[model samples]
Target: MEEFSVRHRRFVANYFAGKVKELRFQLAIVVAGCDKSLSTFTSGGEVSRDNHQAVLYGFSAFTNVIQTLKDAVKTVTNEQLDWSKIERLRHGSFMRNVRNAATHDGNPVISGWADGRYFVPSKIVRIDGFGKTIEIPAPAEDVRAICLDFAEDFCLLLRETLIAAGGIEHLKGSKFSIEEVEDAFANSTFIPPFAKELFAQNREKIEADLKDLKHDPIADAVKELGEVIQYCDSVKGD
Candidate 1:
């Protein structure tokens, strides 16, 4: 089933790439919509407006990434790999909170005269035991960048995971990659499209026969000769 495997891989790649494109577009739309909504605010009003959308988009994007990572983890076939070590699921609700504080809850907005440039309020969000709120005046860029970083990492880990699962460890001792398995399909005697697929379907049987022949050549040849004789005798009698 070399032909089938090749076609299947192509389909998977195309399928995932389409998904990536769609999600990225959705994220962009979220950002754009937030920016558009904030644009209507005048001067000081824009401060709260920008902060609100920044927090809104950041939290939504982080949540979307978390969900996507969870879905990608389910697609892998390898049981030996520790998905936990690489998966982002461990990040928990804390990640969303980080975005929230950096984006919302009055921490991200600073009370001041309006500046023309769009700003992200990063500092000015700390609560003490005495129940006092403080504003740090930190830059908004930091929060936006952090959320974006998480999103990018999610995309990378998901792709790497599925690729790792397709490992052809059966070829390990032979110093062969799946390349040899591919070569088996490439043999012209096997025929096109159907050839590789046929071999893939019968690989276990073919491998067993090969193993027998390698270890017991005399017996294998004798068996072949006997089969030839039986075939000739049957044809003659008929």
Candidate 2:
């Protein structure tokens, strides 16, 4: 993560957010433990599913979303965003692990419509598996929805990062995640005023981010405020 101007930080963060929402809406919801599902069953009618897929699926959006979020941190921190512990951020652990399970167990798609905010988790459940019942978190409609909304936030984090880092060219087209994005953004020293153009030079980045507004992460840009993102090294050195 390189140091970023205010405007560039916000630009990338918001961009990936939109993509996350659109992708969440597209995932298909299906029940798990059903026969003929993607996960294969065992010869003795006992099947074991690789929950890793669910983990990967859940974070797929987030990881991609974060590619740019690093920029948000760099813009403020003037250093690299720490990817070592990205999964440690609040609400990220349970959700990422949980959604992976859902996807693995055949809960193809999980979504929420309540509270005018929706998020989907990759649904996975263990039924008829060879081992004991896996205690995956019970799917709550609200959690699902918030997950989607949070995904959008990640998009914002991504856009800010990318723009701060001088766009996808710096990322080398690598995919990032929401968790990574927000974590990096959280580490910055210059949080853009939500919905306010914090950096005049970043206007072009903002426009580029806007051009690909497929996720619509910021319901209202003017109202959205940027944060003072700082890096781990910055703080540790402080």
Candidate 3:
């Protein structure tokens, strides 16, 4: 476990906070489309391919964000955070196994729709290498509830972890509000015309982060030295 300064801890906490917001936003888009499909999977209704993709992608991200945050905090000896213990509580074991399978499986692409039919029964079932079919329960309706629950729990855990690590004010700048995003998604039945706003926001944030990263004097000096070395080598060859 590596020790991190308050600054670094805050950075990591804020990073995960943003990720959670992004995940919730995306999940809302999917849930909007799958709302009916989830509550009434047995009923005949057409759930879009994109909607199914959203659920899978969102679920995978939710798992990964939790895992990364817990792992990083576990290394903080001053805080006594334990990764393994976290995974053992509150459906944590189930989440870990699912995340591992989704991340490391040989079949990289898992589908919510097959042969123009949407998956129901609230689970993703597949055959393993030994010819055994593995069923992971993930009902679409349950997915939404689970994600919201996890998000709340994650935020609380992260706040505590950061404070323990001496970050008194970390994660305060996160703009992804779970309740607001949920309400926004809930009020709409379809993917809003402006649902693409999140993508644009992400792009702008990336640009801002790049700008902040460009002020390294040592890196600039190294680049200049490399250019000079290349010029000298070219002249010598001449």
Candidate 4:
């Protein structure tokens, strides 16, 4: 039984590390695509078909990340994660519906429509299928934003669950250490390797554009965990 526990923790640590890397790559794609698509939409230009496809791809990626996090928590703690308790995910049905509509129904296209009262044109990705019509904000930036929030909340929940289930000591033999995990969570930038050159070339403008749109859920998660770890260490020292 002890041997099994050791092997299980090792497997989980390695699996989670790999999954995080993949999810970060997916997030990079989503962020870059959204930036371009949103710029086009905001400038009153029609979003290109390629950009529309990218947004759909991002939706699929975001859905995958949510499922992966839920599975990871269950695997680590042997308890199901209650998605409804997750604030960002509680209202995420629309995103799942959008993914289903995009995959099963016809492709959702970016369309511009005026707000009811304001009459200012805004973009939306709309699709009709599965006995319903689903519309999500254009460029799918909201989807990306919600996914970031969900990931952070899920991490904090998993941390608490792990501590309750016997604490991080149980993961001793695993490749994941508390410090390493904290570092990963602290580095929230999600730029992919292929985009490095492009990002470097436009760093100034991109940074300026994203200044108001910065989201740092991962950093928030790390900060909370750091506080808990500090308290635990202090208690042990006393």
Residue ranges of candidate 4 with Cα displaced over 4 Å: 1-6, 43-46, 87-90, 93-144, 174-238
Cα TM-score of candidate 2: 0.29
Measured by TM-score, how close is model 1 to the native structure? Answer: 0.35
Question: For model 4, how does the per-residue alpha-carbon lDDT over 95-130 read when each residue is reduced to its tens digit?
Answer: 444445455554443233222111102343454544
Question: Could you give candidate 2's per-residue lDDT for residues 127-184 as a string of tens digits?
Answer: 5346666544535444333344444444344435434543433322213334444444
Poorest 10 consecutive residues by lDDT, candidate 2: 27-36
TM-score of 4: 0.49
- Name the lDDT value of residue 214 in candidate 3: 27
State each model's C-alpha RMSD to the native: 22.5, 17.8, 20.8, 16.1
- Please write out the lDDT profile of model 1 over residues 193-236, one tens digit for every residue: 87778778887776655444323222222233334334323432
Question: Which residue pairs of candidate 1 clash?
Answer: 1-196, 1-197, 1-200, 2-196, 2-197, 120-140, 123-136, 123-138, 124-135, 124-136
Error of 2 at 228 (Å): 22
Error of 1 at 124 (Å): 14
Steric collisions counted per model: 10, 61, 2, 0
| lDDT of each candidate versus the true structure | 0.43, 0.39, 0.49, 0.50
TM-scores for every candidate against the unseen true structure:
0.35, 0.29, 0.48, 0.49
Off by over 4 Å in 1: 1-18, 30-58, 78-141, 167-238
Question: In candidate 3, where is summed lDDT lowest over 10 consecutive residues?
Answer: 214-223
Give the distance in Å from residue 30's predicted Cα in candidate 1 to where it truly belongs: 4.9
Sort order, TM-score high to low = 4, 3, 1, 2
Better of 2 and 3 by TM-score: 3
